[model samples]
Target chain A: MNIPADLKYTKKHEWARVEGDLVYVGITEYAQNSLGDIVFVELPSVGDIITSGEAFGVVESVKAASDIYSSLSGIVKEVNNELIDHPERINQNPYDSWMMAIEPSKASELEVLLDASAYEKLCLEEA
Target chain B: MKKTPLYQAHYDMGGKIIDFGGWALPVQYSGVLDEHNHVRNKAGLFDVSHMGEIMVRGTEASLYIQRLITNDISQIKDNQIVYTPMCYCDGGVVDDLLVYKFNDKKYLLVVNAANTEKDYLWMQENLKEEAEIQNISDEFAQIAIQGPKSETILQKLTRCQLEKLSFYSFQNNVNLDGIKALVSRTGYTGEDGFEIYVSPTEALELWRKLLEAGKKEEIVPAGLGARDILRFEAGLPLYGQEISQDISPLEARLGSFVKFDKGEFNGKEALLKQREQGVVRKLVGIEMIHRGIPRYNYRVQFNNKDIGFITTGNHSPALGKDIGLALIAREYAQIGNKIEVIIREKKSEAIIIQLPFLQKKYKK
Candidate 1:
């Protein structure tokens, strides 16, 4: 439910924090809460190229598995290797546990994503 | 979706609800890990009222039940429970159920909730004579208190001598706070536990009473998620996952319950032929040697050739490892054999181990 004013989000519940050329991405609190007790997180490699609106990885819970879609097309600069061993960190603090850092091909792509208030409204509708 | 008798109780306890086979049931009250660990170490209560209960009563009830199920009903004494699979004529499992024998004239069959109607129709179609069958699923509600401390928590309410109830046995007409009920020393979790069957009206009262009595001991209310993980760790076969209409009981490593020496049953001929000819595919345990969680329906391969698929897979909380049960070709189902589970189009290395990923602590 914590939607920071500075962050942008997608319909798939992924959040992006744009900083210069890099965007740190992770799932929102609503996503983690919906998918309870995350046991395993599949992350893309650091140098892997990912396309926008496509599934880059998977997040598995005790009951089912869900796909983690990329918000914008980018080259993964850094992947959070910590999530491989401790995936429950997302449940504790989803915004802080960023999955990967990507250098987006077009920074203007952020404008198409939902802002804090719009994203909050979307989450409310989903609930 | 159908709601159980304890649905309001679950809502009050902050249970996260989900749709499970058309039943609106709680998947967890607390988190899955906490609830699962509590059931392994301490006592955890579960509302299993969604399970179907059928009554077969008549002068020839015992003989009729013996002809339908795979287990030896004649060998079990009164008030004893026998676990067995009811199969079709082709040896494919119709459903796996527990037979609770009260006497020669009456017996109770507990079956999976999703397969209740199908099983009932099948039983009706095959009915010869003498025995009367009725669906009594809505008449009773079941609650399971599982763990090492289960008896300690439940004994505070009922005057029944739980110590006298051996494993796979039950006591009828037990006084549970002035309400007559049946208490069985059996559970799906691989722990010492008791499954109590009571009237639908008494379900909420009993659940609240048990929770209140075990509050000091930190007993939590678990849901279907923990129930699934516990059963998986115990290597118990689930109907849809382990044994289905497409999967035979013999291929599921449940041949011992087929009781071939006793007499003829529904699938006896096909099962006997299978036993004699040898099973082609076998269910085996697989542990991930690579960095991926094998999930249900994931393709399995041996040396790049597709052998089979994973039936049930998950991250085992008890063993702290990723494990799964896969039905693979018999040649690749050996212990220590190397294989790969295809997860999201990627093949991850895995090894075939024993059936149970964790050792069971059931009170035999």
Candidate 2:
């Protein structure tokens, strides 16, 4: 599990990369590895309203379909269109295949997200 | 959760373990799609020891078995196996199982691991004559080596001529490098393979031996996840999904094994009446025209009318398409019939297709 120190993480195994007012959302390495061979990924639309801890999209592997939780409440400003046709990118490089870029409505939620070290400890405890 | 003998072996090989029914089994090793293609091209080994095996032995074993299953067991000879469904009087299935005939005095039934207890109780409740029923699942361990290269790989260890074994047949007391076992030329995958059964005590050694022997053929240890997809693609009926306590074999398109002329059996009357009137529902294959995967228990409709639901569905790498098995009204089962598979809250476009997406490659 690669928990990069630069990004903030959630207990649900989602990561947030805060860039000014925008926070890029994608599942963490542990999440993608757990859901191997992702055959399909349903992306949240660009204009969709997303709430923290709520599922805005679905990520599907061969064996199961998992809900992708939003770590920050926001309006989806940009969607990763590449992942719709190539969901395997999430498995190949989860950090690079960011699912969405949200303009945060609740900026304080991003402050509550776990740091990389805390998330790393959480993964170890779960393991 | 129950653990099989190969539970530790799976962990040592980096297999991702999950709870399968009540058993702690590996759901995947490398990945589902990779293992699926490996079984299609090369050979893949599976730990199927969790499956329940029961023995019925007596002078009236054949007669007892005849009244239990829907298939004509009398039509099969010694050392052969017949696949069948045990049904309730209401025509609902008890379980779909494989009946292995050792002789007129003895028989072995391989049943679903989850339904073992229920199946045994059903047999005991329906016992009509003097016979012995034993749940021998714990005493034995089963491993299946499946694919095009399976025979060549297993041939390296066993001196028994693999070429001589016919499909749906088993040879007992076989020597696989000093390990006594029973090798059957039968498998759930729609590919050529052998399912070997051995004593539970000797199973781990045999598992390691076979993997080492099959190293040249690139045999990977597969899990239940791969097994499900292979069988699904092969158009085989699963116990809980395809046939269940609520679903009958007739509706599952397994009427071929239901012999109307084969003497009286458990559900013969109701099944016969069903045959006379024609089955009300049918299991058909459907492929998605919409982007979403038509998953299990998803509602299916025809012209906004709820007809049925998806029993099983997933993204198939072989077909490169999203597909599923749906149990729907008989009137809506026509091939090329445009239908809708309700994926989530939305109804997605799908078309009724033939049962098997691909032809089975069983050795003739």
Candidate 3:
């Protein structure tokens, strides 16, 4: 529910923080809350090519496991290794817990995402 | 819509409300794992008032129950409880319920929340003319205080000597802060606990009092989400998933609870025949050998042939891996057998293994 204004969101409930050519990717608060307490996070491997809308990893909770979709097309440059042991960090701070960093194939792909307000409205409509 | 007495408390505690079997209730609060671990290591409170309580009283109550149930009532003593499955004529389980004998003429049947109305109607239609039946779910609220610290916390609030009550035993008319309650040493989670049945109006006060007494242990308010994971970890069978009207008790591997040797019940003949002839299909545990999580209705493939389907599927919080219960052909249900779970179009390899992936700690 906490949609920060500067971030962009995907219909799949992933969020991207554009920092020039480097984009930080993680599941949104809505996704984290929906998934419940994250017990395990399967981070995308570094240097793996990720396609937009394609599932690259999995986020596991006690009750269910959800596929983590890539919001943008890119090659994974880094991942939050901290989440391997303490996946609950995503539940605590979804915005702060970046799952992976992708070096963009085309920075313009970010344009396809919904802004904070539009994403919030989309979530409301889905509910 | 059906509402529990603690609906307001659930809303106040930030519960994600959902409609389950016409009852609007909390699916999760805080988070599932947080509440789950709380109950495992510390303590957690659950509002299970949505569960049905049916009272059978009269001289013929015992005889009526004996005929309706598969378990032998003669084996259960007064103040004792037995968990058994009520079945249809074909040996398919209608529901798994707990039968508690309060006294010579009094008995309580605790059934799943979703099947309350259906179960009540079934009893009414099948009972002999001398029996009296009453659906008392609305009249009472049931609260479960489960965990290692559950007994000590509950003991502080009630006058009854909690130590005297052994597992599956109950004490009636126990005074709890002036209100009368029935405290039973029984719980779904494989833990030391008590399930209290009290007047709906007194539920909030009892919840508050227990919370106050369990303050040192940080007793959390758990929802159905935590309850599911806890029960799964304990390898307990869930009604809709592991057991259903289409699934027989023999197929579900719940033979221990099915008294085939006992006197005639609805499903006695079929179950006995199945037992004598040998069962063809059985429910078994499957752990993922690949990356994907197996889910319900997923096809279980072995040797390129469809053998079974997953019943209950989830990532085990305690095991840190994907696990599920599958009803597979008897030939494919052996331990260490290789199988494939079709998770979303792609097939993932899984290993046929024994259940309770994480060993249960029943708080001995």
Candidate 4:
């Protein structure tokens, strides 16, 4: 529900914060709330090439396991190793606890992502 | 999806609802870990009305039921509950249920909700004796109060001397919150607990009354998630996961429930043959030595060869370790056998240990 004005969102409930060539990506607050008490987070390794809309990792809670998809095609530059130990941090602050940093193939892909208001509207519609 | 009698109560308590076998049930109320720990330490309440209750009554009901189930029902006295597996002719489990004997002329069978219709049809098809079987699942609602403080909380409502109630026994026509009910000293969680069965109309009232009585004990409302975890930690066999139509009770380490010495049962011949010849696959406990949570249906391997698959696995809140139950080849079922669980296309090291990842704290 907390959609920061600075970040772009995807339909799969992922948020991307663009900082020059690198885009820090994590799941949205809606995704974290849907998945209660995350016990394990499998993140993509650094230097791994990921495709747009493809599953790159998994997020397992007490109830079920869900696939975490990549928002855009990119090479993973940094992985959040801290999440492996404290996956519940995402439930505490999903926007601040970024999962991975990726160097996108093209900066123009950002245009396709939804803005804060559009993303909030999409969440409302889905709910 | 079907809703239980306590559905509104669950929603009012902020339960996270999910579809479980076509039933709209709560997966968690407070949280899975919190609810599970509360049951282990203090007390917790569960809405188990989704379970099916069948009443069989006739002059030959005892004989018919004894012939239908695997456990020795004749040994049980009146008002005693016996856990057993009803199997097909091939020694494969049809379903696991609890038989509550009222007398030779009457009895009650509690079955899994998802398998109720199938079991009813099977029982009808295999009916060789004269008895009346009625599906009374809709008429009743069941709630389980589990933990060390369960008696302390539930005793405040019922006038029956709960201290005199032994395990696996029940007292009918007990006054619970001014309503006539059947209270049993049995539960799925390996803890001192009571399972109260009441009419659907009085279910919500009894649930609210219990919550109020146990407020000082910090008894929280639990859901299917905590129930599943607690049963797993207790090493209780679930029907679809541990024993299914294709899986025999002997393979599930439930041979004790299948009494070969007692006369003939439905799957007695096949089970006798299986006991004579060894079973090929066996269920065993596995603990992750590597860093990964083994999930259901995950392939288990040794030396790169697939030997089995995980039935149930989770990050145990009590043990603080990743544990699972796997049905593997008999050769790999030994204690301390090294294996690997293929978790998300990655093999994680695991070792076969003794079952019941956590020690049971039941009151005998």
Question: How high is each candidate's TM-score?
Answer: 0.98, 0.98, 0.91, 0.97
Mind giving the per-residue lDDT tens digits that candidate 4 earns over B1-364?
9999999999999998999999989999878888999999999999999999999999889888888999998898999999999999899999999999999789999999999999899888877887989999998999999999999999999779998889999999999879889999999998899999999999999999999999999999999999998999899999999899988999999988999888978999998888888898999999999988888899999999999999999988888888999999998899999999998788999999997787877665
lDDT of each: 0.92, 0.92, 0.86, 0.91
What's the distance in Å from true for residue B172, model 3?
Answer: 1.1
Off by over 4 Å in 2: none
* Candidate 1 residue lDDT tens string, B161-223: 898899999999888877778999999999999999999999999999899999988999999
Worst lDDT run of 10 residues, candidate 4 chain B, spans: B355-364
Report the error of model 3 at residue B251, Å. 1.7
Indicate which candidate wins on DockQ.
1
In model 2, residue pairs whose N, Cα or C atoms come closer than 3 Å (at least 3 residues apart or on different chains), thus clashing, are none
The order of the candidates by DockQ, greatest first, is 1, 2, 4, 3
Question: What TM-scores does chain A show, candidate by candidate in order?
Answer: 0.96, 0.97, 0.95, 0.96
10 residues in a row with least lDDT, candidate 2 chain B:
B355-364
lDDT score of residue B305 within candidate 2: 98
The deviation in Å at residue B56 for candidate 2 is: 1.4
State how far residue A66 of model 4 sits from its true place (Å): 1.5
lDDT of 1 by residue, A45-86 (tens): 989999987888889999899999987897999999998888
